[model samples]
Target: MKEATEGRLRLTILGGFLGSGKTTWLRHHLHERAFGRVHVIVNEAAAAPVDDALLSAADRLTLLAGACVCCTGQSDFLRVLLGLCDDRSGLADPSMRVENIVLETSGLADPAAILAMIQAHPVLVRQIVVVETIVIVDALNARTQMEQEVLCRQQIEAADRLILTKTDLAAPKDLARLGATLRAIAPGATLSAARFGSPLGLKDPWSDDEPFALPEISEHDSSPINACQLDLGDTPDWTAFTVWLSALLYARGDQIVRVKGVVVTPAGRLLLQTVRRSVQSPEILPESATPVEGDNTIAVIGRGFSQDQLAASFNHFSA
Candidate 1:
């Protein structure tokens, strides 16, 4: 927790793999006001962003959708950072200036690349001081993810602090092994556990546990993950759609890493999310909240699937 330079703003980068609970943790921290008078910038790989709707607790929020900041959206990301710096400089009252910023990066992003981008920039390097890099790890699915995705391993290696989410769902023995594995990967990172969004004390009863052997992932090992959006027209059949989604996950869960969307149902505005084959209970959004522009459209993030294929499959099942 190094202090920011006298005039520079402090920035914290929050990154994690797909379905790793980054948003959940961020939402909670924002509600708790963990970062005083902070601004939040959320990046989504999908064109239709859903996570931004859930993070309403920030004092000021910016959405950078349709690209990951590490690569395709690098220019936009830099522009936003520079704009914030300019805005702060223009403020005559030092008390009115925003000194802290939290960047919740898209799951596909690499924090290391982003840090390098900032350090290499002439203006940003002087205006912003990155205080920390916190990455969330999915306790339940990280074993499979780490073995399959090189990006996942890169995220862990770049973390200054690692927060293991879904700790309640994972067995104690498995949790110990995963903890050991993460330590092996990022020895310098401080590790802790959380359930849903609340911090939990992690007790490693199995002190003698061995780390899981992670195999080398080659360029040819898997298909690149992409975010594809599916439009559920104004009038969607909730019952039929549920069935189609369940069947899709059952058949292709391995390829479909994450699914998230907001939909207006008879019950209310429902926020839906799924990770692999596990479907979280749908949460109803506040009735007073403003409507999301992309309601009824879901973003499917994973490999081995296209938008057309998803649309056709839903149509066939619903028909």
Candidate 2:
């Protein structure tokens, strides 16, 4: 149990638009047997359970149907995660010492929303660290998808690594154009090309020392994206903040992609997160709070909201 509390669990989220080959890539990875003692969570299993079936040989894998982790299925996701914590001896699988977790989100899912939830869950923050966000882009259709689906653009924008899949099927000229477009959309992310299940010359991005880079929110109106950071200082009223957050999310669920923060409340340090309208229960921080210079800070990514709007809403939670 002590080891579970102290040990590190690295988490990697796989995201992409529909038909982007996320499952194929994951299936290949599993086949390679490179990921050791890792648990897998397949979201939106109802839409396509191929990934889940592919990993069914593993002793610790979960398939979540009828909901995406970013929204209706978040509570279930948290429960499954808590069960994976090695400290939960009663629930965790003794044969499998979980070292890493790979969450494959639905093609239509927004990775930002899932990332926010992971960052703001108390148990998760202490027991697991997100290593990277890998987004699969279909080289043949990425340009069209990016232009048509807001979720597609959001996925690309939030990725730490963008893997262009189906390259063999795409024309060389089209692939090149897609590459240029992705660079413009996700300038800070690492990009690579893959054909079939094999990543072409791409290296694994998760080493213990690798730095996690959160996605940057755009300030330009042309992008329909905005990122707001709120510094709530060292302490805040827990009840007030929760109330304000719930009301705000309820009112603007359609516009918000996600909200995640570490706040020092009067009760104790807590992790808070919301995806659209599903707000997860705040968990008490572990004995040691991850030091971040400032005690209480929150980051939000969304559309149709201005910084002023977010700040005003946050004002109600001010200590």
Candidate 3:
């Protein structure tokens, strides 16, 4: 790991599209102590954040939920960064000071915007040195995402290193094509593959594959993706909720990019997640893993729908 210059703290921006496995990769890296004496800042576009629970391995963890740090949450993000710098400066022992700060940006964030913000800020520019921007790509969905969402393309273009995730779930040919497509989007970025946060060698080299055709997506072409929180109340009917979620995705999967939350069930606190139309197997969190203030509420991310409509749909289904 390269040390920061002039006693500045290094910052690594971890960015990706919705459900691209950013948290999984960060969690593994933290467990491995990849960033020595690191402080992690996780920004979630949704008010109900579930990723923080999986990132307890960080030396210090701060959650900036309910907004995208690149935009809506810029003030809070800056405040947090400034606070970290202040705390470090106060430390008497130079060895005890934090070495690195890893910012896991919300999936919806444009890393370039965040970088520009940091670079433009006089204080942050002096105190923090952005080491790299590592963007995680969803191997199974990048082609489709790049075609539909302008933000996805921007994320790729801003990456210093692109980590293609969900490599195991994608077909070999598809993975190769996606890798090539990513390279084409950002020729300067180094590419690698990972599965469930573990590094994996690419089966087919991107150089040997053809890049997928990407359409020009205008910023106004699609409805803006937004996060809508649905309160499941204190006790949620797990089976019924699952059925309703399945039906909703079946009907509006294209409009609903991601669904995630932690709900208390008979078995345990189950962490539920869905990427597009595909539902991942629910993982039971450890007993010590506690949900934030907004537990039993799921954040549905995408566009073309309202929170009122989602709530009504769930209520009718459960009733």
Candidate 4:
């Protein structure tokens, strides 16, 4: 971790179904001039590591797609993320100075589950807090997918920013209808749209006060399944204990659905995530160097577990 002065590496998670122009939305985040020293984690379910156009920079990018981000590769993601803070190899010259991390999950991934992984980590939750859960919806097939695929519906419902993309393919009336539907589903969020080839209207948020305050959730939206907090505190005895603990949880892989949290390891602060079953490496972050923005907090979600258990594990590592 770079020890950011403010304890902030404002993070944003981009979740959308397959080919919904997520990469397009991300390209805007990557090329913007103000987003200096940004890091990206790309997740895929295939073995072929496809290049991420959004992470256009050869050096600052880390791809984790092919990884069973929600299952098989959870630990691998954890190890690699912890390694990033320590590994000077592939990192940029300002290697230690890492700012925001943009996570690109698989088309079939579950955003909520992955978010829990990031919020549960003891270190990451403290440093790199999530600014928003932006779910990009495709105008064309979104309605059909939502109707037929429950996972698809969950993705849209769990988002803080509902981005409608691929508008070119949808009829004007259909697009308007879909947009209205999404607004109803997430009345609390700020809504917006972007076409694939067009420049996204979003400005570099780092230039201002921490990206708009976490979205205010309506009472009905207050459930843990969709709402989870990633808390970051002092580094954990992550050496062998954390590794063993991760393994124990991974062994029960099938039962674990989603995990997302910012974790602080002895090496550095990182973003941890799991979707479906595979996990993406915690995006290692440091605030010792960046300005401290706020207090540290981390939380994770599981299918049949208690938040107390999660809190207890993290408390065990308090400095």
- Top-down lDDT ranking: 1, 3, 2, 4
What are the per-residue Cα lDDT tens digits for candidate 3 across 1-319?
A: 1445687989999999999999999999999999999999999999988999999999999999999999989999999999999999999999899979999999999999999999899999899988999999988888889999999999999999999887778887787788788778998888888877889886555575889988877889987899999999888998899999999999999999999998888998889999999898899987645445767999999999999999999999888
Model 4 misplacement above 4 A: 1-6, 85-96, 197-319
**Which stretches of candidate 1 lie above 4 Å from their native place?**
1-4, 288-291
**RMSD to the native, candidate 4?**
16.9
lDDT of 4 by residue, 64-137 (tens): 74455655567766665555544433457755667666677766567787667767877656655677788888
- C-alpha lDDT score of every prediction, in listed order: 0.91, 0.68, 0.90, 0.57
User: Which one wins by TM-score: 2 or 4?
Assistant: 2
The C-alpha local distance difference test score for the whole of candidate 4 amounts to 0.57
> Of the pair 1 and 2, which is ahead by lDDT?
1
RMSD of 3: 1.7
- Residue 180 error, candidate 3, Å: 1.4
Query: What TM-score do all the candidates reach, one by one?
Result: 0.97, 0.58, 0.96, 0.55
Residue range 177-241, candidate 2, lDDT tens digits: 66666767787898887776687963332212322222443434245444466666565676777
TM-score of predicted structure 4: 0.55
Candidate 3: lDDT over CA atoms?
0.90
